[model samples]
Target: MRDVNPKEWLALGEDLAPKLKDFDIINPHNFPSYIWAYYVKLRLGERSSAIIWYCHEPLRILYREITDPKGFRFYSKYNNPELKTIDMKAVSQIDHIVCNSRFTANNVEKIFNRAASVCHPGINMVETQDCDRKNFRMVTRIYREKNVERIINAMVLIRETRPDIYENCSFEIVGEGADEGRLKTLVKDIGISNIKFCGFIPDKELPAFYAGAKAIVYIPLDEPFGLVPLEAMFHKTPVIASNQGGIPEKVINGVTGILIDPVVIEVLTDAMQRIYDNPQLANELGTAGRTRVLERFTVDSFINKLEKKFFSLSGVK
Candidate 1:
């Protein structure tokens, strides 16, 4: 699937458009779907509300590549100026827009000059079994943007500065990506015994990992809207995330979880110790995080808000 080109995906979607009929909504998820939905509405002469999910537009990817060179290196061939123009046109014709986070909403408004309603995607509450929550776990794709190296450096700092807490605590990295080999080599060279790379855990098996974690350290660089933070919250696990991107929207500093600047290793080390030294603080944050997820980030809540937005746009009610 990774071998297939974006144009091929768009072509396949357009080919299948004629078969679909009588839908109340022409909602599109990725870039291919946007092109597909536009053509489908035109072919069927459909009056259905065309609401774009507005997740990953290629222009944004291009911008990210330009702005953050050290962050992620995207192939130059994928940066198509022609597709950007087409994407802007397709977005302009849509009846309404829904963004996953305020970070994404800001981008949509800036590019399209249109306001977007933010409807955060939902995560299910996982039932936790009786297991000892000891180590700090990070469940993210091992990439430069994920800042797995920063977390490891912070652990090294802990071992040097605060050896007491460092001796007792452990760190676990889950999920697989391009940076996995480099990250494993880093832990080995640093001689960090506590940190281990646990390769990709299936979705069904994720509940146990989340439930058993003492705290989830998710400090990704400019994450649009991460589900890991919400999923961790649902499992009643406190998180220590970076104070950037959509993460701030999910975690409240000193309330739900600790937030730190990713560059500051000392601050991150302190946050880890604070949670380790004080179980009361951990419990408070964990309980609050779970409550926040239940009230705001539930699937039912997302669906209800989406229905309202769609109905309002179409004037059905």
Candidate 2:
């Protein structure tokens, strides 16, 4: 696919205007789609309602990377006034706005000075046969923002402080990214041999991994909407995630799973040990997590909200 520039996005919008003229609800999923809706509105006026489904505000990630005190390296690349202007225009022109999580809704309020309805993405539950759920696993791309290294460091702490718990427990990292080599080097440096990097696992095989895992750990920086925790919960696996971002919105502390300050190695280590030493507690958390998913995060519930929103916006009976 060709990389679309802002000028191209505007041109594409003009092209799509006539095609989308008759649609009652022209919902845009991204910036380009926002442009399409904008042009459609310009062409069709009140004949079509333009709603923007923000899968997190388009520039929230860039903003976070720029404002990161540790490093503002990404900021230099995205410091374009024209891009921000277009983004603001797209946000302003939308008839209604919706977001994937409350965290994202708050960002929209801060960035666009607009309130948004939160319609979280759904989790598809999968069936799996019995297997030994005796290991802790994290399913995520190995990226700096993911804080995957924090989990690895916490595991090393577990080995030093609670060798007994460490002896019986295993930690696995699944998925691959640029940080894979660095993470492997860190593990080797720490002399922890039990940690295994499973690389990328296919979606079909993921259910089995989740089914047999003791728990999941996911703690990404300013995560817009974390699906790994919910996916794990759907498989009846407990989760231990960072207290920040959209994680707290789903994984209720002491109920579905444990939430800790991702940077606190001792706290994470304690959580790890708690789950390892008490299988009953783990099972309780896992069962509760599964209940949470069934009630709140299923695909049916998500689609129901979207359908309701579309009907409400279009004045459909």
What stretches of model 1 exceed 4 Å from their correct place? 1-14, 44-49, 54-59, 65-78
Tell me the tens digit of each residue's lDDT in model 1 across 36-105.
6665555555544444555643344545543344554332445666666667776776777888888778
Candidate 2 positional error at 207, Å: 0.8
Candidate 1's C-alpha lDDT? 0.77
Worst 10 residues of 2 by lDDT: 66-75
Q: What are the per-residue Cα lDDT tens digits for candidate 2 across 1-317?
A: 13547777767767777887766677778656776677667666666555545555556434553234355122344455666677788778887888888887877777777778888888887788757987889999887878888888887887889887678768888999888999999989988887999999899999999988988988777677889999998888889888977889999999999999887788888888888888899999999999999999999999998889778765756
Reference-based lDDT, each prediction? 0.77, 0.79
Give the Cα RMSD of candidate 1: 2.8
Residue 190 accuracy (lDDT) in model 1: 81
Q: Report the CA-based lDDT of candidate 2 relative to the real structure.
A: 0.79
